[model samples]
Target: MNSKKTSQTEHPPGRSSTPAAWGALAVMASLLAAWIFFESLACGALHAGLTCASWMRGDQLSVGKLTYEGNGIFRANDVEFVFGTTGHRSSWKSERMEIHPLHLVGMLIRGKYQSFRLIRELKVGKSKLLVDRRGAGDGDRGEASLPWSESFMNPANFFPSSIEGGPIDVVVIGDAYRLSLSGLKLLLPDRWAGKVAFDEAQLDMGTWHGTFSHGAAVAGWDGTSLRLENLNLGKETALHEVTLALRDGRADFGIRGTIGKALIRGDGAFGSPGDPNALELTLVGENLQLGPLAELLGQDRRASGTVGQARFTFRGEPDNPLEADSSLRLVANNFRWDGRGWDSLRLAATLTGRKLTVSELSLQQEENILTGKGLVNLTRDWHEALKSPFTAAFSATLDDAGALASLAGPQFATLSGGLAMEGEVRGAENKATGYANLQGVGMKIHGLPVDWMKGNLLFEGDHVVLSHLDAWCGQDNISMEGSVQNSQPHAYKASAQIDVHNLTKRLGQLGIKTATTIGAGAVKCSWQGEGTREAHSGSFQARVTEWISKWTATGMSGSFDGSYAPGQLRLTKAEFLQDELKLSLKLNASARTLEVTDINATRGEKEAPLVQGSIALPLDAMDVWESGDVLRTIDTSGPFAINLALRGIKAEEIEELLGQKVRLTGALEGTISANGSLENPEIHGGLKIGNFVSLAGEAPADLNLTIDAAHGEFKGSLSEAIGQTPLLQMELEAPLRVVKE
Candidate 1:
């Protein structure tokens, strides 16, 4: 062969003189040598020891090291693979490789076939896996590759596939318990970072059984320079606690502990690293400790009650302070806050917000329920917070007895009637310097037994004014309007006008039995006074017109002036109860006493038989005195008579009408005393009837006779006088009683 190669080399065939057979022989010789050298390298002992290789016909070539542990089991090391380089052109590489011992055991157990496990620590290098049509014969055929494979040359196809029946489990081990991977380069669509993987990872399933301590060791992903601690996960639980620190745009984390069972999920983003300008955080968990959360925010957790199943989302931008807004909403079945005893009675307000429109707000504690709805604008400035009053029109109804009894301590029991109020408060001050306007406000004080009133009331400048106040008591209707200024704290002034028709019914409703009728009248009266708790004094006057009563006067008209100072009402005139009696009387010791004075009265006809009398009265008789038109007390001595003197009067005419001498003469003093009924009181005195004649048509003689008898007794005999024949009848007695006719 050497001599043939030399001859061919020395005389290369010229293009025109070369024979086709010689050229073919020379080419065949060169091909045989190249094939021999390639076969030697493949079969050599050193080459077999150094190179690990596997191949599939017309498809792939894999090269690595085989580790033989004296028990007939083999493992691959530092594997490199290629697929279809001459035909398909695919390739792959790995830093290390592994084969399972169970594969060899399966071969020993079942002797019919070979069994093996393939394990590998993968480290992919830069490669362009491709498919080319030029590799196929017959004018280039089609190529086939996987969907994700770059081309047919992609060496991932060189990965070992299972035999028709293979070992079930594959075990892999590496330098570390879990081989953490980094610095991987992968090309993916859409500029997304490709997934990274860990190799030969070990899992211990026993850490899921027990409870995690409050502050306990948990599992996490760890790195050389960074660590994420306490990453625990399981079916319904996760204990994945992670804290990330970033400085100057560099952030890192690594595993510090073994992973356990709870699925803890949390995400946070902070800007500016050490000096953040903004922060956003989200957390979701169950049975989270609110105390720790409040402590993280520098708040007192004990001030608020515990909550359940919290999902929190927060975003804050410290850089743009002016345009910042925040909102919070919490839902819980029940929550309570402690009131620090004596401050505000442990109150809670629902649906409070800053710059948010609230549909409803309910405040409740103990037996109180207060609800409101409107817009609220919260501000940091306290003055503005108070002054920026919300426009909330509200109606409140409260149980009067329950509300009052709550504040009244133990003084009273069970009240009735609910108090309802509707009003609007504007520009309310924090220190109570504000006023509210009340419209269509009414209150009914039920169970008050006396009167029920309904009216409009207003509150202004610390005063309460009632307008159109209509109160009804039984059948009487009383309408009143008044204002009470500063009516609280024991200092106030009130004035009202009260009108009532059929005042008798009103008095009866008030449990007063007054035998008088205050026919339709309005008592327009006002009083002003100042006093402390000890005493009160004021003056009032009322014009009483046509005040008729059965016991006193009919159609009486007068004005009564009175001054009241504490328990006394002093009346200046009691004249209307007595008609022209001209007597001063005082109501002392529940009895009427008269100051002594002259009294005159006239009754009956003015011409035929008019009666007049002047009498002195005593105060005692006026006590029980009763009369239709007048009341007076008189002293009546013997014979129930009144003494008087008369002249130029017809005694016989008065006696003829009176049936007797109506006047009596005193026996010892010769004074006339009248003793008769008030209609025709008889006039009596020592006097003689002067006989002239009847003044019918004839002139007559004028004669007079005198009588002398003691003790108002008259002795006279005038049977004949003047020119009459026997005009005087004989009077023969020691004491002659004259009966004039």
Candidate 2:
């Protein structure tokens, strides 16, 4: 009753005040004060970050300059927050972030979010932020948005709405490639799923770098597919519109682009867009220019032509392309390497690891073609490959040598023939071995048709053998068989027959007509060569029958046996035989000296000497007549001799060789000897010219001379009188080496 009286205050409508009402008012006042204090704290700088460890449970949520605008508008500057809930570190921060004005309270009060822009940085599993790209045509389109990071939205809801600040670098492969993106903006319109647009994107790999500008794409709602617009990959490579779909951590993509000067279309599947490790692809190329591409690879600068068509498939890691398992088929049009050209080229091959298996290979130039199939080491140098051992069936044909004028010479420009070779080739390099069945049909040389030409060509080790080879022109034919060794002690053997009539005919056909008279005849020859590193030996035998010419004796037989070393040569025997004339010679020579002995020319079978001579020459004597030191050969290689004897030789025989009528008869005998250095030599020799006749026909032109030198003094006198005045006389007590300059 007392409390009622004391609390007899005014009440709105007959209501009594109680202790509970006062307590409620006190609690309300306390709460108002606390709310004001918390708001003040929220708007202030908190460099230490507000650690909500107990309830909200998070790392440092640092904030700066948190400002509150009336009407539920709020902004946070320099704020950072992280959510490590997906068993992965995912964090985001911004220098200036705009909280969703409409749903800020709902996001804080109920845990539902619309969007906010953390335009600075984001990280997830060593990767950068994801962007939600929305179409620009959408009426509601403004900026991109990102998803709220939670326990479930590892990457799905992590797409950011907008990206600012610096570029976001995303490493596609470890040290292999780096992709960078800038100015990313994403939005969600009403109808279509979403879209993407990039201000710039850069890709770097090894020595190559590519930049794409103003790229755009139409993306599916679930972030699983994208259709990109045209984008140029620098100026070297480019790509057009294509669709990329992702499923089960793999992306299937198809695009048309250019590689080097080639137009390429391809479709493939790879590990993932974020990080691709393995791939399976199929690519087709058309009109692929070769020269520019070859230059890019730093190969033959002269390479040219085009690959008409190519198809290939590869399945393996992209890092090691050559190690991939692949199959290829290529057709090249008018392919050329260096200066050599081919009308077309075709190749079908498969590669596994380092082995390249060829199913077919063909090269064609006009009617000439070469075809073969074999295996090769794909990783080996091409030069080494050419020198490697391999087995293959090869077929080659040569038609119309005119097409190869640069190689065969201009004389063969009009040559028309078909030569075919088919065989199995094995081994290579020093031990190369191969064989071919060679055939020639309708062969013509400079419009002169050949009756026949057939042969078998084979090679084993270092020797090349030509067996059962024969050539015929008109009524003339020659059988030939020879072997040529290519080793250190190289050697060769050859045999052939020469028909003068045919030879003259062939020469006449070559536009080189000669007026000199010649007799019909045949010459047979056999020659061989064998050698060692320091010495070489060779022999030749020739027989001429029914042969006669105005300048040469008729029916001559000759034999030569010789050997040569580094700087030395020896003619063991050299002899020639004509109807009634014979000549024999023996010689030895070195770099600095020459010696001839046993030299004689005889007539008749009785072997009567018509002329004989022995001469010695110290070649080093030339050194004194030249530059520098005047050390004559005689000063070094001493003791040499020279002698000559001429007997009963008619000048008419020599006149026939001159081919000019200088009426003369008889022969002259002469001798020469050296007794000192080349600079000053003691001379003891004589010449008998009285036996000869002069053109003046004056008394048969009797003339002779005598010479002698002693103590550097020279004396000579005419043996015959020149019209009663001793034809010529000379005497000198002074050294002949001295001259009045």
Candidate 3:
């Protein structure tokens, strides 16, 4: 009753909570909770979705185990993926893999306009792969990222597009994927093929797309061959089409291309892929450019213009490839050899079977031209042809020595002027022999000057013979013939005969003093020898006509004739004539000694006999001819004797031999003999003087002097008295000492 009625007040009526609004709130809350729940289950669902998609595509995947974690992370252990059909399948295996499933969903819902972040890690044995979101995006128009692979697939038939280099991008649009790369390098597998790089590269593939290019390309596959077309390799070459096919036991390849402005075409085939190689090829080039080819040939050369044309048809084994028909002609601007450059070269040659013919070959430089032609026969296997005899005929005409020196090496470098040769040569691998007619003008050979030369050269093995040689030595014209046989083994036989017209200044050139060669004369020289250099058993003879070697002795002349056999030599005649004196000698020699048979001298007329003598050296006591002593080797060694017989000699003539002037006029006669060893002789002789007169005293009737050999004493007596009495008598004793005089 009384309860709290005191505060009774009026209360406005409020609308009660409606079921529809409560239901709306409950629906919104349920939506948010369901979204969170679905997000939590995303990893497992994604894995199931992928499995279902793979199954629909008829692809197979084997996984040892699968796992799911928070934040939509899915993982698998031991997973294998297979692509392609049942007949030709490509497979890959992975030890472990991790993927973010939510990221894939985000990419799907964003409709490709927004960037989807992806993070993945895959491991296979020793190789690994990591993917980051930094480089994978919308073509080249957005930020780019690349996946990192730790290892490469074997055979490398396909490669994934990468963006680790300069600002490259990749994107997926519609049913295709595209990649853009700039300044990229791709490795080539061949050792000598080099590498292929590009300034900019682009690829877009839906299924099996094959068209691609840079400067060169493997364009597409047609039937059984790979076709490469429309390639521009710098400014040097342009290729139209190239095809390569390998099938069964045959391989075929061809090229239809252009280099510079030249058109080139070739086709090659290889039959039988076994031990021996067999191939047939036909190559034709028109207006082939030489400028670009010079770099590939050598760096020491430079060239320009074009070779006229070349045709080569070859069908043979590798060892005999040159057995086909081939010809080439070229004109080069600058040709170089041994670091020396020359100007302009024209070359042309043809080969057929074992015959090689050079039609035109010449070099022109510095106002010099060298032209040559040759025909050669190579009739055996390549190596056997080198060792066997080959026939060749060649001729060369040189306009200048410098050009010949360049081609023939340094031996001819010092020579100047021109040379010409015509020869037929036969050769083995290590030796060559030939016959040639050589002619030259204004040449210097071995530092000996010649104005002109002509010779016939004959060669056999290591020997050369110069026959009928006409050359100029100084001002003298010399005609000579010579030959050397067996020169290499050093037991040589040589002979030469020279006829010289003038010998005065020519002798000076041979190192004889001008004063020694005081007169001009003609000389005839002949020599014949057959021996080694160490010991020679030969002889030479020189004869000079009208010889005058001194001014004071006007009529001086000499003649010598000598012969040398095996161990013996004979000087048959040696005579010298000067004024009123005549001397003659004959000598014989053994291996180690010499013997003078007789030495005779006569002054004045033979009838008048102012002085005449016969001198003899008799050594007949010992037999020691093998000793190295001239007297002992040629004759007996002990008890040498000298005998002299003289008549009609004046005292003044005998005083001339003693270097004294005598005023006595006398006719002397003597018979002298000395006998002993050469070092000591016993004298037994006597001299008689008759009708002697001197300016200082009166004439004596006769005087006699006798030498006693046993007593070593001399006795003098006046045979006829002057003024009715014997004028003088004397006895003297003196020891005799003998010495070499």
Candidate 4:
């Protein structure tokens, strides 16, 4: 009866009975409350569990807001996670983090996750990152997705080494990680970059990918090892593969790249970027183009060459970096630099903390070689280094000085002889002190012929001291000692002691006409001159010895004390000594004329006749320096005079001049005065012979003569006679004629 009645009480589909609907509604409501309660409890439990785990993990976890949604989903707003000790902690913040309950539970229960994802947009300092993990296999094999943008790639946020700029993807596969970029632009700081060493180096890649493997033993990365593949930097610079390894406070890297037309192979290692203990490093490059390298260094000049092999090594620690050990070597072909070039170059150098040593530095071309070496210091600033204190020793040997014509200028273009020099230098570059000894054979300087030359030179600042110089000047040996100063404009002081052998031959070689055929002499001179090259003035002193010219032998000893000031030169003392002749003169000169102030001459002893006079000589008369004439050119414009006094004379001496035997015994006394042009003389004087005798088949005769040169008349009378033809008289009148020899 009850079953029949329940079957008969069926309600329409759209409408239900009040009692049945009420009961169903109550059951649904209860289920909803239970779902809500479970969800809330799950969210709360998750929050509490993570908080407790954070404490155990030495992490500080904070959440701004926590909420739960349908289907076992939970979200946290403004979540923060801090790891590490308080003293050195790192923190990460997330705008929002989402968790799927079922997936989390599965990961926990399985112990090893096949797949799991924790999605968040995280930030560290000023950078933001999107991190996700797809799967984890016992914490060893995992697939992680870490995408970053420009705002998320900052060097300071990570390690001390620098990096910047990226829209990159970091992917994980098993125990390895990769960074992939379609177009990457990167800038790295110096001291840590692989191929380029600069304050900042830039690398542009159209597409690049890198991978690295890490171990659990390391806190951040197992070891500093980065492998790059498929890197296209630019048209001029590209690399197929590169590997960088940093371990044990050191870095090592290798690269195979292309720079312009040259294939580049490079390997290098150095200490940690900022390690306190000195920086020790070694770098080697093979087949590297210099042009592109110069461009990379921001230099204006372009170079063209390929370095066959180059090596650089550094050692030792420096407290101030000024005393660091460094060295460099280069082997290159067709090397060009600074508008000058060389065919092949090989250089090796070493720099200790205190000094620099150049073991080998040379340039080779066919049969010519130029070698050089020196010592110097290195400083942080080039200018400071150039001005710092230093001592250096250098030696150069050249097969042909013409090979260095570019450096020696056009004046030395014709230099074609072997040259060698050894020198030592001390002090700074601008004001240095040094000594150099140069030797040359069969050489010519500025068209001055030299058979063999040797010079010892010392220099200080702008002052040069030529201590000793001996050279063959046109088959003549000349030795000179002098000093020259160039500290001021046109202000020079020079002193020289010059000794010449075979002066006549040397002068002839110089196109000079000389009266002397053979001569040897020494001149000691000192001059202090100032002004332009065209004109100069100063004090001058000269001492001459053993000077013999023409048929006259004079200047066995001579002295000249003179001074040139302004436009005038004054000779206060000029004297010469001969066998029995002595001459002294004083003179003054200007641009117009030379005035002879005083002249005195003596023969034999002090009792001999003395002559003195003055002459004004035109400056043009002293053109010996220009005409190269050894003979004196004395053409005077003003009045000229000669005074002569004669005492006793021997007959044998008269015969010596006349070249004929004369029978004469007499004492001659006369005073002669002449004043006129040197070419023609006007004489007014008288001669008297006492006890004179002429042997012409006759007896002796006393003769008296009267001469009036202006009137061209002479009167002579023989007063005493011992034989026939005594008391003879003669008078003559004739035109004056003077002969010059």
- The lDDT leader among the candidates is 2
Weakest 10 consecutive residues of candidate 3 by summed lDDT: 154-163
**Model 3 C-alpha lDDT per residue in residues 485-593, reported as the tens digit of each score:** 4334456556656556556646544444444424555666676766665656666665655555433224345566676766666777766555565556776655444
* Residues 1-741 of candidate 2: C-alpha lDDT, one tens digit per residue: 878866765435655489998899999998888678755654552222234221133333666667765444456676656543222333455556543233445435542443332211221111244222111112222222233322323332323333223223332332245566765444333225555556777766666666666655554333345665555544355566567766565678887877577888988887631232357889999988887566544455565789999999987655555556889999999886545678998999987876778889887898888778976554344445555556667777877444444334555556667767688756656455778776667787666666677888787777878776876776666676777775656666655444433344565565545334443245555545555445655655544554454445434455656665566667778776665667788878775676888888887866668768887766642242232233333333354566767665456655654344658765656666655444455678776654455556555555676778766676877655545655545544445663312
User: Which stretches of candidate 4 lie above 4 Å from their native place?
Assistant: 1-254, 259-263, 267-274, 277-281, 287-306, 314-321, 333-343, 365-369, 372-394, 404-416, 423-436, 458-465, 475-478, 483-494, 497-741
Candidate 4 residue-wise lDDT, 400-433, digit = tens? 6666664446656666566777888776544568
Among the numbered candidates, top TM-score falls to 2
TM-scores of the models, in the given order?
Answer: 0.26, 0.57, 0.41, 0.42
lDDT for each residue of candidate 1 in 493-595, tens digit (9 for 90 to 100)? 4444444444444444444544332232323333444444466665555544444444223343334444555554454533322232122222221122223
Q: What is the lDDT, from 0 to 100, of the residue 133 in candidate 2?
A: 16
Candidate 4 global lDDT: 0.56
Which whole-number lDDT from 0 to 100 does residue 45 have in model 4?
Answer: 87
Q: Can you tell me which runs of candidate 1 are displaced by over 4 Å?
A: 1-420, 426-452, 482-490, 499-559, 566-568, 572-741
Question: Which of the two, 1 or 4, has more lDDT?
Answer: 4
Model 1 lDDT-worst window of ten = 163-172
Model 3 C-alpha lDDT versus the unseen true structure: 0.55
